[model samples]
Target: MNPIATKYIKLNTAIPGPRAQELLTRKEASVPRGPFTTAPTFVVKADGALLTDIDGNTFIDFAGAIGTMNAGHCPPQVVEALKQQVDQYIHTCFHVMMYEPYVQLAEKLNEITPGNHAKKTFFLNSGAEAVENAIKIARKYTGRKAVISFERGYHGRTLLAMSLTSKIKPYKYQFGPFAPEVYKMSYPYYYRTPEGMGPEQMDEYILQRFQDFFLGDVAPDDVAAVILEPVQGEGGFVVPSKRFVQGVKQICEQHGILLIADEVQTGFGRTGKMFAMEHFDVVPDLVVMSKSIAAGLPISAVTGRAEIMDSPNPGEIGGTYGGSPLGCVAALEVIKMMEEQNLPARGQQIGERTMQAFARFQHRFPQVGDIRGLGAMCALEIVKDKESKEPDKELTAQIVHACNRRGLVILSAGLYSNVIRILAPLVITDEQLEEGLAVLEGVLEELCL
Candidate 1:
């Protein structure tokens, strides 16, 4: 570990740490109304994979800012680059005037993404913007009006993003009149087994369902794109089988429809691979990436075959804050950090460690139900009955709260909210991870045993 990351704080009381509680009070008075906070602690500062609360208690970071900061908190190279770029310039709309960092980062993304074919990239300020722009590009390129997305997949919070996203209770309950021409498909989640369906049954049911839609409801040629996450994120850290992913690719190819891989959460070394799609041989025509790309500096992009990307007319895709100098500089440094640390390989190693740690829990706790994941990204779906595999949402939430009290912050997902998703920073110390997992086991014991 670097000198900048060796510092650790001591915990003395219930989290909010007194000072954080005061800040939380001030936040209720001044902060925006929409942002919902999960924890009682208010951070004073963060370094490496640890966050210091207002009272100076340190907590191991597991959320990674919802899949950002994969390079870990305030990575030295990225922070230094941000500092240096601040002295130059902040924003100059790329459409009005080009900048070196933007062009350079785009080049890096194009070259690094899975493809040797000619490709181009467009920068955006957020993941939602990138998804929205991808729709524009796909529509322009294919001259089609319909798009298909998977169930339980999370795109973003924008109006159109809501339509593309499939979760109803939380993401889409009252947000009506979302963008039109968006269709939904079932994501391949093997844990719950969908209607008590087996793997082979699930595969056939999903395929036949899509075929029915294509033949009965909509014409395949009218479909512009089918957007999917290589590995589902917020919906659950569901890792689709190689057969399922390849089957989807085949369907898209048969209809001449474009395939869009939403790697916003899975990209930038979240999975063992740089992009989650690398686990399989399937190559998508377009790849949407964000979150950790810039190591938390708010940069996102859509990259793929140049010919399709070029279909958009001038002024079709550009943002004032898109690909800011600081963001691009941060991204370049993030890439350098990944190379220097071999983070992708490290991600694979972390996955192995997670498996080892989780296996012990599986043996002791029958309610573990299922343990599934890849690289540094993984999740365990809890159950009411191990044999029945019924979603135990209440149990999962209890486990999360217990873990929080133990100083391990974890996030939950899945269609029924019974899954515990773990997305730790790829650079977290092995000792921290082991300690966090041990706390997590204790939380499970309290909830299940």
Candidate 2:
């Protein structure tokens, strides 16, 4: 008997078709508008890189739940592990009664994350929680009050993370009285750099600005950590040069300030490397991970040097449901799958292919102002024209909606909301990837050309 070939995607109805429309009505009434969604319809089932709506409209998912499903949805081994965990126990909670899976996952993270130093890890419930706790650990470890995060870098939605985040309208707008002592630093944006300034020059300029910032904004001794996303995610897949990242690390080292790599969106093989820091050959003092950590389970972790992580007292840095048994088991399984399949290499391959496709699109359309990425995490900056490079936020929305209606699920990012980002599962098949890109290309042709 021959195995069935994967069809990948099938759209029998309009995106909201009738069933999704009904659910959308209920969602509007029951759910607040605070939580934003890229896809217009709610999904009933997801597998690998495909999401099936209640209306039977199947979409090739390019968003990957905002970079959470690198191992793809409902991976059989992970699912089995989760089931076994359920049968044995579910919610013991790390604080109340410690579990083996929690410790095991911590050990795995310590071993695999980019570092040779002795490391320790603790779990949390979400990426934001991971960021929040990482800051707490850094502050306690350094005995300082100020934390610096880059402009256009996104941490999370919690008060401290929100305060650290760069975007304003949605993530921060009107939400003042924010966490204090958080300073915004200049991050190099090479594409938007002053004409004639090369990448190296831009990096140098930003490093110099960092020095000036320390002199003007806060004392270096008073700073706890410098947090950054290796490749800015919500800031639109902005890939900083390796020199710049290392420079920041150097500054932190010189000042005795911890460098926190916010790997929440870039860790666990979304990037070509297990952690984006690996690409730069710089090991961060502290690493915040979540998103793809547990195959979409609501679990996150802060992994760092043992000494720094130990700074927080036992009772000082944990929550009731911090490391649920399910999350731990799922994370362990996810890690195993990532290693067994070498998903990072797969992500690298995907990135190359997607970038090639994006390059073609850029050549065909003047509105494609920029095509940038670090790995499989790729994005396109939409513009009103080639020369002006004015962000086309409205056109970006049109492309996103059109793609969704045509059986593709994509997302918009960046402070301007004019960038289209691709976070397709690393496990996505070549055919599926080509098909999804084709859909996007068709949408671009219709709208831009």
Candidate 3:
């Protein structure tokens, strides 16, 4: 068995070791190739910021199940809550039976999510569902048809959500005849800002294009909502300035278009703040949330202004498992954990440290083209060269694969798939975080140097 010297990551064998290989064979037969997996090995256990494969290899989990474990895997309180909840009941179907946890979680989200305005929240099964429902509510409230989403923004995989998403390959390619009336707009990618334009100028240009779009493409009055990620997720963790975000909000207000904050990956303390929207000081009419909401539970929420949220008739929204009791209970505990432990501040610390390392990487490795993040949601944009600034998709994949093989779980993002993203758990110890970063650094040194 091959092993690496490390504190938390214990590489007992090659990534897909004997045991994992057997399971992989089975998985290949049973599971479709459509659903992608970052790590080749199957995880037997996970906790805090670490995961153990079936082969007994332990890995520091930087991916955090694609930002679904900000509170960390099997957080004690959340696990305990789920256990107690299971002991009481598992699925009563909130649609059929009224449950307190559902109402309790909704109340908690409304209170914690940005904006002091009277807000209401409803639960859903996934981020895509939340996006779909949020759009429905926006359209119902405004009686408008068209909706606008930004370039490189990722909403979800469902029809409407996929239509709203910007990425083409893997997500939208061959999945067409996408949802109609959904439009795309340019979101500022400052790193790749046009040849001569400055960041603020770029922002103004994109904002102005909205007016041009209204005249050339669709009327602003017909737009029900303009959805955006406060910090783009699959779009490479790209963060827009407060001016850019507020500009979008101003336009929405001017045209009577609802602003929907798709915080699926940026919410739940992942972005340092409780929600990324707080960074921009823009309160959205509708907020789409999932991922870290329930500490890995398959639960999502649409929290927004009470008036906008209540636009749909009573039975117009909701599903069989929309607000499962276990999800509600786990979410309640997750929020309590975030609050009592001050995870958002911890997330900020993670981002600071991560960006610091990334900055050093930029100086040391020419391929480390750009580094940007908000809170713990950090990323390194890989490029062929600093001058060319051409995306190095191959190198990014190699870095990710090398890191995973060496016992650090990581992920890739961006339209070009050249952004190495870090979504480490906030509860990770400094030593663990350092060790994980060290693994990544080592991979960069090996691959880029």
Give the CA lDDT, 0 to 100, for residue 410 in model 1. 78
> Between 1 and 2, whose TM-score is larger?
2
Per-residue CA lDDT of model 3 for 1-449, tens digit only, reads: 22336988887798889999999999999999999998999888999999999999999999998999999998988888898999998998887888999999999999999899999999999999999999999999999999999999999999999999999998999998999999999999999998999999999999999889999999988999999999999999999999999999999999899999999999989988999999999999989999999999899999999999889998999999998999999999999999999999999999999899999999999999999999999999999999999999999999999998999999999999999999999999999998998888888888888
Model 3 TM-score is: 0.99
**True-structure Cα RMSD, model 2:** 3.2
Candidate 2's C-alpha runs over 4 A off are 1-7
Query: Number of the top candidate by lDDT?
Result: 3
- What tens-digit string does per-residue lDDT give for candidate 1 at 347-443? 8888889888888887778788888898999888888778888788888888877666557777888878888888889999898888787778777
The window of 10 residues in a row where model 1 has the poorest summed lDDT is 1-10
Give residue 329's lDDT in candidate 1 (0 to 100): 92
lDDT by residue for model 2 (4-109), tens: 2336667787777888788889999999998888788888888999898888778899989989999998999999998888899888767777889989999999
Q: Tell me model 3's lDDT, rounded to 2 decimals.
A: 0.93
What lDDT does candidate 1 reach at residue 70?
Answer: 89
Sorted on TM-score, highest at the top, how do the candidates line up? 3, 2, 1
Cα distance off (Å), candidate 3, residue 116: 1.0
Report lDDT per candidate.
0.85, 0.91, 0.93
Clashing pairs in 1: none
Q: Identify the superior model by TM-score, candidate 1 or candidate 3.
A: 3
**What's the ranking of the predictions by lDDT, best on top?**
3, 2, 1
Tell me how far the alpha carbon of residue 303 in candidate 3 is from the true structure, in angstroms, after superposition: 0.7
Q: Which residue pairs show collisions in model 2?
A: none
